[model samples]
Target: MTDITASPAGYDIHNPSITEADNLLGQYIPIHYHFQMLEDQARMTGFKAALNYLLADGGKVLDMGAGTGVLSFLAAQKATKVYSVERQADLVECANALLTENGCGDKVELVQGDARQYLPPEPVDVVVCEMLHSALLREKQLEVIESFKQRYREKFGGTLPIFIPNASILAVEPVSADFCFQGYHAPIAFFEDPGSLSTRYLSMGETKPYAILEYQADNAIELSFDGLLSINENGCFNALRFITKNILAMNLEQGSTIDWMNMNLILPIKHPIDAKAGDQFQVRFKYDAGGEISSLINAIEVIKA
Candidate 1:
C-alpha cells in the first residue's frame, strides 16, 4: 500500500478523484466507438486473460503504458497488488485520481517514469501492455514489451503473457486525396527521383498529427500494395494499396478478414483529387517468401492458378 500523502515527486496530482480522473484521462482512453472498431478488443478482455495467465490468487500484475490505468483498474479486481507504469506526467496524475477515488489507492502503485528504467521491487507474474501504435508508429510496443519479457524470462522463466505480436493487415481506398499528393507535384518524388525537388513538400513542422486509425487481421505471410496510387503530375503518392510483408503476430485461417490500422498524415498544398471515402476497395494478406510471384491478389479475392 502506498501512502496517499507520500511526497515522492510531490503527488504531481491534480485531484485524486474518479470524476476528475474520468474527464482528465482523455488522450489515451480510446472512445467507445473507436475501441469497438479496433481489431484488438483484448484491452478489456485481455485484462481478464492476464489473471488467468498469471496467479490464480492474483499475485501481482504490471500494466506497462497503462494510460489512465484502465487496465490496472481491471487487474486490481483480480490482483492482490497492481503496479501501473505510465510515461506521461499528466496521465500519471489522472490515474492516481481515479485509483484514489475508487478506493484502490492502497492496492495500486502509480509510477511516473519510463517503464524501461523503473524497475519493480520484484519480478511480476503478469506484464500487460498495449504500447503498439498503428503499424509500429508513435509507439515502440515490441521493444518495450520485449524488454519486459526478456527481464521476466531471465528472472523467472518463459512466464510472459504476451507471447505473440499478431500484427494485422487491412486495405482500403482513400475517401479523399489527403493522404496523397503534396504541393502542386507529388513531393515524395524526392525519394524516388530528382528534379522533383522543385515540386517540394510541406516540412514535418507544417503537418498535422499522424496516427493509425483502422484495424485489420492477417493469416497469410505476405501482402502487396500494387494498385492505382494517387500521384500528382508533380510526383507524390497517397491512398497506397497497403500491402505488408514479414508483418508480425498473426493467427487465422487462410482468407480471413484481418484487422489493421490505417496511417494518417498531414501535409501542405495537398492536391485536390477525387477519392470518395466510400469507394469500392479490397484488402488482402498472404504468407510468401523469396519475392515469389506465386502469391498475388486483386483484392479480398485471391488469385489462384
Candidate 2:
C-alpha cells in the first residue's frame, strides 16, 4: 500500500490537534497530498466508473470541492458542460494546466472559490462532491453540501441535482486495541488503513449500524445516537471502530454499486470497560459533523448492561 503520511504536510493519525488542523484547513493542504489521492487506484476507479455511468446521457454537471479537477475532466467526457469549483488557488492553477494539456478547456470551466458559496448560473443535472471522512467527522463534506443544497433550492426551486455518492452508512464495533508501540503506550484515536495487518479486530460485541446519511435529503448538523450492542465474546472493550461506506453510484438495472475507499477509524474510550459473553452495552454519543473528535470523546457515555 502507498504511504499516506509520506508528504511533508501529512498528519499523524494519533495526533488530534494536527489532524483537526488538516481537516479544518483542507483547501490549504499541500499539493503532494492531493497527488496521493490521485494515485489511489481504487478511489479513482470507483469515481471514474460512477461518473461514466451517470454522465452517459450527457448533461450539465457541477463538481464541488473539485480537487485537481479530475472529476470535472471525467464529467466533460459526456456532459455538455462542467463547473469545477476549488477554493485553493494553487490547485486551481494546476487543474487549469492539466485541463489545457488534456484539451478539456472547452468543456470544463475551473473556478477558484469556496464550494459552499459557488452556484452555477443555471441548474445542473448532477452535483458531485467528495469531501468525505470517517464517521462524517473532521471534514466539511456535510457542511459544504448542505449549504449548497439550500442555496440551490432557493435559486432553482425544488429541482435538485443528482448527488454522486448519494448516501453513506456509518457503523461501529466494540474492540480491544493495543496502543502500545515498542514499550511506549498511547491511547489515541487513529485511522487504520484498509488491508493493514498492524491493527487486529478483537471483537467484544456485534457491529451495529448507527446512522445512514442520505446526501440528497436534509440532515442534522449535530447527531446524537444511543443504542445497545449485544456482546458475544469476553474481552476488554477498549475502543470503538468506525466504518464509513460511501454509495458512490448505483445501477438498478444491473444491480451494481460503485464505492470509494475510506479508512476505518479506531477511537479509544476514555475509560476501557471489561465485558463478558452475553453482556450488553449501552453506548451513547453526540457530535457535530465536521467537528473535532475531542467533542465526540467528551460526549461519549458507555454503560455496562
Steric collisions counted per model:
23, 0
Which candidate has the top score in lDDT?
Answer: 2
Top model number, TM-score: 2
Kindly list the per-residue Cα lDDT of model 2 for residues 142-212, writing each as its tens digit. 88888999999999998888899878888888888888889988888888875562445566778898888
Poorly placed runs, candidate 1 (over 4 Å)? 1-57, 162-238, 241-305
Range of the 10 consecutive residues with the lowest summed lDDT in candidate 1: 202-211
CA error at residue 303 for candidate 1, angstroms: 20
Mind sharing the TM-score for model 1? 0.46
**Candidate 1 lDDT over residue span 226-296, tens digit each:** 23322223322232222221122333455432222323222222233333322332323342221222222
In order, what lDDT does every prediction score? 0.43, 0.80
- What does the lDDT come to for candidate 2? 0.80
